[model samples]
Target: MPNPAPVPDHVPPDLVRDFSYFTGPGMCPMRGGDPQGALADLHDGPPVFYAPNNTYDGYGTWVFVRAEDQRRVLQDAETFSSHRRIFEKALGYDLPTIPLEIDPPEHGAYRSLLNPLLSPKRVMAMEAANRARAAELIDGLAAKGHCEVMTDFAFPFAVGVFLEFLGLPQSRREEFLGWADKQFHGTPEERGEAIRTVIAFMEELVALRRREPAEDFMTFVVEARVGGRAMTDKEAVGMGALLFVAGLDTVAAAIGFDFRYLAENADAQDRLRADPGGIVLAVEELLRMFPTVLMTRIAACDTEFDGIAIKAGDRISCPSMVANRDPAEFPDPNRIDLARENNRHVAFAYGPHRCLGSHLARRELVIAMEEWLKRIPAFRITPGTAPLTYGGHVFGIEDLRLDWEVG
Candidate 1:
């Protein structure tokens, strides 16, 4: 583990806490771990605390534990810049993850250019393909009556749909998955290598699309104009790289968490199975209960928020799991209510920097759950075997061996 950075002089010692997404309680790898739920205790302390060594690169950050406070911090992008340069260390220079890392006004153009591609209507048009992919994977696993949900269905289903949207051939699924695994879950050196590998792939893709334009996403990007000019190589590569990284892991982790919940809570599974219409609402509830992404921001300049001192260049972490469980935000924050109503959870972060692929991700989760419940009967964690989960920049599940009677 990287050494935690020294706390800044401006931060109050009373407000500093020893917590991090990498090694905090319930954050470490464990069987049947509740990485999200474990942080609910934060609400009992200060709503905002300084956590030294909070990031993958071992930097201190002000941890915001309340939903409303997080909303203010995230929405006020001017004060809390989103230009985190998340891939800087790995790539050996600054390469903002476009739209995601770009702050407002300047961020608007890129967002507008890409929003239509993933709007609700566009996602609806892709529903058949998404559902088909989910069904295909589930059907293949249904007969076995037991399988590792993450590898057998979740990763393939989510990554395949994303690949299709990106206009990449399915033949490259394993290769992309390998890179995603190393990129998101590997050692620092491995992560840097994976980051370089993905950028190289995207660079090649941009070059290919420029030479041989096709009816695919990269083609459209290469041809499309932003600010009345075609996108530059770096811009194009950033767009593709962001999509590649964002699209691969998050939805799959969600599917794993959702299935794990259903497997453990048979009543909830049976309820959703009996009333398939409820799956949409149930998915929202599940997303609220088990979000995997952590939103981080850099203090654009020295600013005071909620009476806490923040310094320029300081990292700020707004964990979705922590905010979703804030008592002030949800009525019964801990309960898993499948039919939750008026749920405005920030499973996807708020403000202009909200996840661009959220529409497709939502439909994908609903379809995965709907198809799985419809095709497979009651299932549970395979006896004596545990699904190992861990917390980090992104939380994930592994060895999720679910089983059911083969009929």
Candidate 2:
């Protein structure tokens, strides 16, 4: 039973051609080394719209700019829709994930399904608990003085927070963790195995919630309503999968990438350690540089601007990673300056679909950085290590190889 008022059906060719960012060959085509370079690319070009690569069809993007020319693009909900079917089509799932890919007024209702628990007050309540959890993990391994930051710290930290929030028991936490890790990982074959295991577990949990109705996020979600009608089981499951990825791995990537960048730049780490207050601005800068998720969205109707053509039904991707470094917005964008005030970098994106979990993510990051810097501020990256890089749909380091000391 498809919802009434089907997704808009008239994407224009002119609009598609001018909106190109993620359709081409590179990951972050602009921001890393020089902010000026980023601005030039966004400005000097013919309005930075999507252009077709020779190899692909119906794929293009216009990475939006933060400059005066396009400031309203992020806030203009009417023109830029967030209905996210691109992933479903790519992954071959007829059913879509909740909220992340959907647009208003449906997107608005779906988000209400989980927004209460993610509110700032709730996040503050979780912060102390998160700090304790971070301390426990760090204390357990502080003596070792060296570990695989990704697997040892970030992975467990992400899963533990999510599991606790969902109120999963100790016995079943690993089942959820392992399955969720692979749920967004590997080939379709690998993905199928992960999806089945995790969904089965979620179904069982849903049943348990039905019977017992424990006090947790699981119960909250199970009992969520829109216009007074309760969410269905499938809706619950779709949202389960959504939250699993949304709450867990993206946090993992954000933390892991931050560590990798800090490990490589001891000078910046020293500065951060000296001030500590730098943590907040440093957090903003890091987000500017290392937004983990890439572009999304397929246009709903024909649109045109800047002499490019975007046609209806064309697959378009909006590249956030590329946009944040856009030189027109952030001068010297590659360099991280803690004092970069008025820095309106759109790392979490803009508009109605701007990352709902931004608040929670920022809190976790601030805590994680505080704990790490307090204990291991002057650490050096392990000698003889050429840091390995991994990129797929997302970008992060495989292992942040570092050997730190505390005297």
Candidate 3:
């Protein structure tokens, strides 16, 4: 039998209407023009509010909209644990997607094994390879005059990096792309199937690597250890699957949205084109304005958090999409100020669980923006096509068409 609605009994009647974190008709609506707009209004109403709209088996959750509050939840994982049993219940399976699913001390060990590949220096060393890939993709579209940036450039460029990182064959793009969609955008059944498919593939790959090792992220995990003992096959598979999902989704969507914004805003495009040197800083500001992931935490004990009563086992969501838009933390939070100062945004999230791949993500975005602007002339959204969007755990721009001058 399905669970009943998770709405709490103590929510103020007036504030009940604003609980818009989950999807469905009466649930919170994602602000139409601005993805974060509904959340901006939400910040005005409550620091932490009960939202009954969670679509994962109708579970209720606490929505955290303030930056400081978000920081508190993410940093203090003891109070707000990272264990994701919600997925277990929703998908009807046990999936331990490492580091991200574990809290503190245990998480550190898993993170350490992968840290070398994502260090700033390592990511910087890959700039030449990353730039070459970006240029290759952008060159193909330069002569065509217009293209769907999301499909043609963003997805391929980002996924290409992921493929190279894992030493996976490029011929498998279509097969893996299908799995990615099912894992993230498909129906619950499709998502469950996708997880099974990925795990199966990883188990096979790990078995192969065990007999004949190679130089890649997967091989690293297969050979790595935790606490002086080798990682079990299950642990390696969990880490690999998480990396596959995280690597393909976030950076690709971010690059797509950043280009979509630039397509509509000529001034911002012109400024970056002229300065060139400012692309690094521009990427930071862009991330601040368009953070896409909403992180989840489960409360560890019955406790009072920021005047709100949170019971043990309740769920809390700290969306970087919401926290980055806090007015008090960011002045003129709605406006995209490329020159914004002291931009301490949680676009990569906050605390111990902050994204391990942030350095690589940043490098990819910066190279992508710089390379695209260099090759493609001034571009704008196709006059009549409606841009398609999806909002949920990971908000995405499904279709983005751009028209540009053909040389």
Candidate 4:
């Protein structure tokens, strides 16, 4: 389902092209369309500008398009805080989503609990399971010779790994994904309902874990401590809710976009298929080109940035979609260079609130790509059918029909 909510009126009609911040029209292009072209135009203008409040609900953010400027905002958490309230304001949600919404000092504490669980070692350990799951999914689709990647493979592959990691029911995969899609791209009412529905389910799951703990992520979280103190049930539920929403959609979107890129660029696909060892480097470049998450911050105090005046409580939108495409940061920003050196893209973000699931996300991407190209012959979008995509808080492919020879 698409976001039926109307684009708020306060968003200047003209800013649509330059405000390539959201997923609607100007930002996310049709499959094989050019989004970076619009973002590049914005970069040619002022580095920082005021986006309208209607773009969000009651408040707007100062859009940052330059990579250097984005780093300045992300690195200086003291000036631009990541406290939960800012996100609540940006997305109109209540109840602080731990780690992501919490600022430094305390933020580090939340990361502590989750760090080892998603560490490179732990993620590496899951490689066999992840690869097994990927191969299973491709096995089901390979015989078809043609399939929609988003629903058929990407969603199931990404969400399956997460459900297994969390010890959630694999049978509820569709129900969980439906809720996640609505939460990100649905109307306000639908988004609110999705949040409530997931949180309610999480609350129940937490209670179940407390009474009869299991060997799962939820059990680990409930048994863990932050700052040497046990997390309250509310905090535990909040973390579960956060993981439910965050874990599923992000990696799924990355897979969707990565495959989308490969579908369009057969040469790149061939190169990866030829050299599996280079898949890791190829994944990094793909993430840089199509980062799905946008990092938003609130001005903690009155501040001046790049000759622009920002006041306390003002929102700052540092969209990786915009920042990663910056010519000053990545040479030939539009082209994908698998061996690009020192690719310090903010795809995983920067500072205290960087993505905790980075290790898992990387592993998932690498496994998905390697397995897909190996099983299926070279593929591309079916002629005359445009692949669908959604924008807003997160941008992703909704429908991608790929066709290949049945070998």
Query: Where is the poorest 10-residue window by lDDT in model 3?
Result: 24-33
Residue 352, candidate 2: Cα error in Å is 1.2
Which residue pairs collide in model 4, if any? Answer: 23-391, 23-392
lDDT for model 2 comes to 0.63
Cα RMSD of predicted structure 1: 0.8
Could you tell which candidate, 3 or 4, scores higher by TM-score? 3
What 10-residue stretch in candidate 4 is worst by lDDT?
A: 1-10
lDDT of 3 by residue, 167-276 (tens): 89878877888888888877767777887788889889889889889998878888988989998998887888788778887898899779888988999899999998
Model 2 C-alpha lDDT per residue in residues 15-35, reported as the tens digit of each score:
334222222323323222222
In what order do the candidates fall by lDDT, top score first?
1, 3, 4, 2
- Candidate no. 1 TM-score: 0.99
TM-score per prediction, in order, is 0.99, 0.82, 0.94, 0.91
lDDT of 4 by residue, 1-407 (tens): 33233334533444433243454354554555544334556667777776654243435667888999998899988889876362353345667777777777777888888888889998889999999999999999998989988899999999999899989889999999999987887766777788778878888988899899999988888888888888788788878877876789999989988888888889988888888888989899889988888888888888788656677877788888788888998888887798787788998888877888899999999999999989998999888876766556677776788999885
Highest-lDDT candidate = 1
Best first by TM-score, ranked: 1, 3, 4, 2
lDDT of 1 by residue, 191-213 (tens): 99999999989999999999999
Q: Which stretches of candidate 4 lie over 4 Å from their true place?
A: 1-20, 23-25, 28-32, 53-58, 84-93
Model 1, residue 226: distance off in Å is: 0.8
CA displacement after TM-score superposition, residue 259 of candidate 3 (Å): 0.7
Better of 1 and 3 by TM-score: 1
Q: Give me the displacement of residue 209 in model 3, in angstroms.
A: 0.9
